[model samples]
Target: MSYDLVIRNGIVVDGTGARRYRADVAVADGKVADIGKVTEGARRTIDADGLVVAPGFVDPHTHYDAQICWDGAVTPSSWHGVTSVVMGNCGVGIAPCRPAAREIAMRDLVSVEGIPFDVLNKGITWDWETFPQFMDAAAARRPSLNLAFIAPLTPFRHYVMGEASMERAADAEETAKIAALIAEAVDVGALGFSSTTLNQHMGFEGKPLACRNASREELKAYANVLKARGKGAIEIALTRQVGVLEEDQCELLDFLLDESGRPVTFIALFDRDDIPEAVRNTLRLAAPMIAKGARPQTSPLPLTREVNMDNPFSFAAFPSWKRVFADTSKAAQKAVYADPAFRNQFREDLKNPTGFSNWGRVVVHAVRNPALKHLEDKSIAQIGQEQGKDGVDAFLDTVLADNLDCELTMASWNTREDRMRELLNNKAILMALGDGGAHVDMLCDSGYPTYLLGTWVREKEAITLEEGVRKLTSDPADLFGLKDRGRLAKGAPADIAIFDPARIGSNNHGERRYDLPGGAKRIVMPSRGVEYTLVNGAVTWEQGRLTEAKAGKVLRG
Candidate 1:
């Protein structure tokens, strides 16, 4: 029998947590035709000799809704062997927006996701307004990787409530209509709905995100829609402050699980340096909910970011930052930074022992001022000590001197290898929260799949290769119920990744690229040793480069 493509002489991990075996995988008609000896002639053949051929990595959390409009290839993630991604995470997206509310959508993304407003302005085509129409538009783009979407609650609330969605809880009539929209979105293609309670998720005009205003009754109603359907999952950005989860938050998790019989995946569980026992405590509190199909996602990558005060996304959690967000103009921001009142409040906020409090870990990344270049690698605490000022004062003064053009880097939690190993080994915790397609300039953690393999599996020996592949593949696919994906078998979709285990990983830092719309710059994390990536039997990425094959499908739940 003939085949469309044949991958020869490779070790197959199969993404099932099974033992690895050497096999020849053959594809035909966009499905795996055979996995044994493939002697038949094929139109294309890839010599994956000495490489590990596994199911393509699936990134379950991303914000590619805007980027997908322009970049059909969905780089960095695609470059790192990710064949599928779930977008519209954390209840922020651009669909179901009225023409009049277009600017509102873009501005919300700018504040919450750190995407440049001008970039979104130049990129999104906005050919559709309704949820199903949005799905159709995404499918029409013919992306290079499989794309699945969750109905973000913000836009539907905005569509129904207009300006008041951010101000108060929806009335009975508004709640019914909002629920109807979520149900409509699910009926078409949405996996389920996503909403956020994170205070850091500020939106247009420094207001808390519209979804944050959802009352418990409103959320219970939305969850019931899925309960009745019995075929969806919910992703929520819980009110988890760094590592702190209040009792009410725990009760909320239980309520959502009771309301929605379907699976519920929460945003993140990270190790915190300030509160050393936070991860363990949260896990203990979550143990009951987890037993009831509540999956808490965590990242293999550390929480490190290149912070520029231009957006100040890393500081959104600080109440003192509201002064900066209230007025985004360069002059206003400089004035706020120099204000003694603002500095005192910021310093007081810094004493709260969150991720942002570690001024010693914050270093000056880059500076445009040639005279201040000597301070480029110095820590904020070091500079504070040298100048006999507080760290917050030193940090802001440096930014003020540079006119907010300086770049500082803050490396926070999840760096402890011992803690990460314990987290990665937990079966109840799903591996995710990559935050790809968001934080465009601040970070690029989309290359985490390779990082898991290279650093965790190969180097640290935290987990076996099979377990690592399974975490990146079937675990996430199962979370979203993506059919016939995340595994290698006869009749399964031919989404595959082939790479050298010895050389698979990304660099410690990302390289900046002026590739966004309107010539905006974004940090791009590139991968090494990803030899080939195939989507639906098509070679989309071969030998460190992307091919022109648009084989992606807009996946429906």
Candidate 2:
């Protein structure tokens, strides 16, 4: 029988942690029909002579909920050979929203995820009002790559409790209704539900996100929904300090594992320079929990971001910084930055020491006023020392001079290569949390799949190519129970990535793209060495360009 497509003469990794071998892959009817000696012709053929054929990377963490309403291809992630992505992470999404609460949801994404509000206002189609409808609407879009969803808890809580969701824990009646919504979503197709308690995850009006207000009883009720179904996983953003899991955070993980009886993947386990031993300590603490399916997500890339003064997301963890979000107007922000009292408070807040307090690592990336061009690329600490001023004062003064149009570089933690290797190689640790569709303006970590393949597997040799492929593929697929995906074998769905391993990686910095709705600016990292990407047997991305095919499907649990 003839096949639909044939990939000839390539090194096949197959994505099961197996050794590579030269083979041919054949696809038919959107599934892999054969994996060896495909001599018969097909509708299309790709000569992948020097490429590594592997299962398309599965990104288990993202915030493409709103972006999907506009950009069906999912951009940079698609460019990097990722055939599938799981969005609605951090419990911040644009679903289960009422018509009146539309602005509230958009503002929550703006505050929590660094997406521009105007972009959301112009882009969101708002075709659905419930979780299942949202899933159906996403499917109807027919994106270029496969899309899976997690029912974000914030929108559900907000739907049931309205404005009160952000203020207090839900009452029993409210909790029951929210749980019912989640249950209905899971029954239809949601991989699971996600929520967050990170202090940095402030929502509308700078309040702790709606999920942060959840009491233990309320959370248990939500988890019981998954426990009863026995078919979904839980993703959460825990409140940890300086990359170290505090006692309370550890207890929360244990509690979730006990309550859910399923996999509980938490956001972010990064290395911290201020607390150098934080990673090791957290890994040691997490060893026992690993057996109980507690996976902490980390990234292979360092934490570098371009933070604009208008949206200083890197500093949102500080209590003093909340005032910046209180009034978003340019004039109001300029006044706040110029206030001596505000500067003093910020200085005092730095003494407590979170990640962004390291002025030495913060540099002046760009300036609107050419007169201040000399300040570009100088660390805030260095500039402060040169001017004989405090670092906070120097930093704020520089931005104030530019009328808050200055962009600063935040190169915070996760720089230690030794610590990163340990995290990547750890079986319990999943190399994810790419945060692709969110933070569009701040950074584009969606290029992480290529970064992992090019850096860790090829250059550093931290893990073998086989293990790297498995981590990016089956591990995440199994975590979310994505059936018939994350492998390049007969009978599996033909979502694949073909790339030259020798040259696969993304640049450290992203260039600005004016492609968002209303031509809003966002940083995008162009990939290197990804030759082609296929979603369900269709070549969606070929040689750095997206094809016309929208072969994507809304993947459900």
Residues 16-107 of candidate 1 have per-residue lDDT tens digits of: 99999998999999889999888998988888889999999999999999999999999889998899999988999998999999999999
| Local distance difference test values of all predictions, in order | 0.89, 0.89
Worst 10 residues of 1 by lDDT: 239-248
**Candidate 1 error regions (>4 Å):** 309-349, 371-405
lDDT string for model 2 (1-557, tens) is 78999999989998889899999999999999999899899998999999999999999999889989899999878999899999988888988999999999999999888898999999999999888889999999999989999989999999999999999999999999999999999999899999988887889998888988999999999999999999899999885574778778888999989999989998778888777788888877877777899999888887778987766767877888889889889988888888999888988887775875578888888898989999998999999999999888898889888888988878777778888888888888888878887888888778888888888889999999999999999999999999688988899999999999889988666889999999998998899999999899999988989999999999989
How far in Å is the alpha carbon of 226 misplaced in model 2? 1.6
lDDT of 2: 0.89
Clashes of each: 0, 0
Give the distance in Å from residue 319's predicted Cα in candidate 1 to where it truly belongs. Answer: 6.0
TM-scores of the candidates are 0.93, 0.92
Relative to the true structure, candidate 2 reaches a TM of: 0.92
